[model samples]
Target: MSVDNISRADELVPSRYAVPVGDIEVLVISDGVLPITASTLATTTPPAELAGWLDDQFLPRDVVDWPLNVVVVRTEGRTILVDAGLGVEFPDFPRAGQTVARLEAAGIDPGAVTDVVLTHLHMDHIGGLLTEGLKARLRPDLQVHVASREAEFWEKPDFSHTVMPQPIPDVLRRTATQFLNDYRGQMRTFEAECEVAPGVLVSRTGGHTPGHSIVRLESCGERLTFAGDAVFAPGFDNPQWQNGFEHDPEEAARVRVNLLREVAATGEALVATHLPFPSVCHVATAGDVFRCVPAVWDY
Candidate 1:
């Protein structure tokens, strides 16, 4: 099961939402949604509390339809793609992995991309690049940037600190291995931070994975940060709630809290992979915890 691989024009409804950060232009595209167990979202919270929070958000009690988002940026004569989204190979998640088709629907050619910035090597982030439909279209000199530590971590990933449903771990390893082997030549690994364009910057923030990173867009006076897996839906209301997929739960919480505080203070827009569609918002403090203030939709 997979999303329709037909021509792009068939998707009449808009799947990509546009936002402006001064001179830079960004499009937050939908990669569809992933159905995940509700418990995985707040691994450490008491079941009752988790259920209560879900109820507050009006989400289901058992399986939750988690939104998957990827971003695209245009700046300094460069076209940059953030994360690749869950590619079409995974049969279990038939609705997801729509990055390629949606990219086309947005009038973005797969070959037009000049660079790709991966927040991590997780399958959901890098799998779209592995599909032959995309592989056959990428430019020969396309640059794929990732944190050095992230690439190294996948060599011998440590899952002892994490918990995931059965078969997921194995699928992740296989997909990651395939990605690295296929694109190692095109990859450009960075140590701390790198600028993809005049206004687009990606910096490593270890927690979700040893090399998990976030992208920051700054132009003129506007700022926006793509937190990747650092912040989930439960994160603002319960910053300490540990996500089961985090390689280091404690550090993930620290990362989430700090990132939330930063956005809340600076009043910058934030987006992430698993947050709701488009996932564009500003953060504000609500006592010790935080609150997600959804940005007013532009147009």
Candidate 2:
């Protein structure tokens, strides 16, 4: 079971990576990559500063390949999935929406998933809950947990925004409505924070979205945090930088800083959805700044 053949630099690396947390076993699966221009991150930062930072990190200044790492936790006889990736396909993001394929690659049967915990209702996070034709895709019996506010926000017709074009939001709302209606009995919502499974808790970390949250897993004294787009890697190290895609840049920045500090202090392993593939890492303080130290892959 050695993963010695897998390399991060490979264009098509293995879709699943194993993470050990005491007695619990966690699987990090790749949904796919989303290509975004580096300039779009921290839009307010000066171009010179941003370029210098990217240079220091040895990252391409023009564009970055943002990977989608969806976590699967198996504990207490339960199979729980965190954040469904983009459904079947996304025309705007050609490389995205490979969650289903990746899950199968990891030998996980979709029917075995007892719960789907959505970190937020963003298109990328919730899109995988339905088929391209806008039909529920997960097992009808599995419970789907989402933030109460997030579900409400998408149901309204006037939840307009400048982040995405008019058509995008419209489609999102439509699909959201369909999902809610199709799985009325299985859909559930929570407020603030609550334990969704035996050792999994969802805590609201609003800023990215009204009801956005990060999932916390604890078992046998080991802990892991599934940070759903709370922040990106390098830009987020400087908490002051604001992402252009954030619904509330100021609040998002505040939450990101707090989360980094908390993880650093508690020694919690973090899995950021938008970081590079196999996004499991630990946060640490480097002088006055925060840095991401990637976790070594375990077979």
Candidate 3:
């Protein structure tokens, strides 16, 4: 390639997708990929069964790269950011934590983000806010919207049921603590459900964490659900398969099943945290299981 072409390729591919939910503008920004043990994704499934599923999907059997996705919702006069991606603080995850850069490339100003809706206090969800780079650019009046139970859970998070790596639990605890300490003054706790903006609703699901939540946008006649961690890539195919990241795997699975059914019934689009990049898709019931029909790119 010529030097000019190379130099001009800074962000030719913005790695972001925009979908309009009626009048509400939704942008799904990719935060790159987070690598995790493949086994962890199917903690409740048998080893052979998990391997078969992975092979069917043409995915790696050991380490799998999860597509980390975040969202920006513009409704009325307010700009809301969904869950923050993995930040740049941990040298361990170099490929992840590209949320801040991608946001800037998409022409979104952090200062204009009036509120941040956190699904839970998991490090991957809240680490971006603790980053020195993004934190410095955000406005002082930014309101961090989280479920009241979520904030309380992080105070004494119970990871007994999860199957994450040893070092991960400690790191998660530390990151969550730091995030709360830094943003406590801006916290806006909500109960079961609250409308953050016009037609944008966040409700506690309480499966992945005690206060894990999901954001739903309903405007005019269109609808979309940003299902934080309540839904994952494998969730559509095996809604009963519990994930290791879930604080309560059984309840998490139940929540996943119910959410999938609801989305399928309503025929609204679904975006998830660990689904494929720009994970905008419609759900369809496949007998007992469900399917994610990827939405056409809206250019």
Candidate 4:
């Protein structure tokens, strides 16, 4: 199939994946649709060839689920939402809009939000920031933090021309501009690892985005990391396998290799943006190999 055909196919299916993490209960809220197509999933492989490969691997018949898993973290005194799922409006997409609703379902109020730390400014990650009128959708007064490096990358003069899908850059530009204006002084950015809270820290993990970040939660000797799009699916047995959508596949592969090693060595439970619903998994290493063993949380 052609790339255009694959893009069309991806618009159909979407899945929501999440898991509860530590005292800071985290959920992977879904927004938008996820469709698996030859180009989006395995662009390098010929459409027919990739179809055969996926079939052999026992993946969905011809498509893999392309759901967006937005991470929401709930903490005491304040509710922290990692990435906002899509709002009710967008040109061509369906949203769960459950970020706040689900939070309410969990007994969380939108006004209770104290901080909203973004992993990056991608549409799926930041779209939940507002309603059509620019009103704060989730938590109006929430402090929205984005990585400085990422903010600077797309803001560059040549970034628009560099992006593969032009809409990706355009969306970021619109969202950031609006966020900067609406949130104003509430917007804060960091360059490297900084403790966002007593037990939560944000670490820079670029490659997927120029300034993509992952959140770390350390409490009562239990440490958990919310890896946003860094390790998509553990999709491949090789921990180093790179996804097709990565901004810099080589750099992304390297980051995953290192992360897998570190997570395994420390035996930390991680919540990934895309891993399968309730995406909490622990890393176990055997010699040079690392595996993601999904863990069942008591909560």
Best by lDDT: 1
**TM-score between candidate 1 and the true structure:** 0.97
After superposition, which runs of candidate 3 have C-alpha atoms over 4 Å from their true positions? Answer: 1-9, 12-14
Best by TM-score: 1
| Candidate 1 C-alpha lDDT tens digits along 1-299 | 23344454677666789999999999999988889899998888899999999999999999999888999999988999999999888878988888988988888998999999999998899988986657868999999999999999999888997778988898899989999999999999999999888878999999999999999999999999999999999999899999989999999999999999999999999999988888999999999999898988889
Give me the runs in candidate 2 sitting further than 4 Å from their true place.
1-12, 132-137, 157-178
Better of 1 and 4 by lDDT: 1
Candidate ranking (TM-score, best to worst)? 1, 3, 2, 4
How do the residues 157-257 of candidate 3 rate in per-residue lDDT, one tens digit apiece?
Answer: 89899999879999999999999899999999988998899899999999999999999999999999999999888888898888888999889989999
How does candidate 4 score on lDDT?
0.64
Clashing pairs in 3: none
Model 2's C-alpha root-mean-square deviation from the true structure amounts to: 5.0
The lDDT per prediction is 0.91, 0.77, 0.88, 0.64
Better of 2 and 4 by lDDT: 2
Give the distance in Å from residue 1's predicted Cα in candidate 4 to where it truly belongs.
34
lDDT of 2 by residue, 204-242 (tens): 888877888999989889999999989688644687787
State the lDDT of candidate 4 residue by residue for 142-172, as single tens digits. Answer: 6877788877765652342122344655675
Q: Please report how far candidate 1 places residue 293 from its true position, in Å.
A: 0.6
Q: Show pairs that collide, candidate 4.
A: 17-277, 18-278, 34-66
- C-alpha lDDT of residue 66 in model 3: 89
Error of 1 at 280 (Å): 0.7
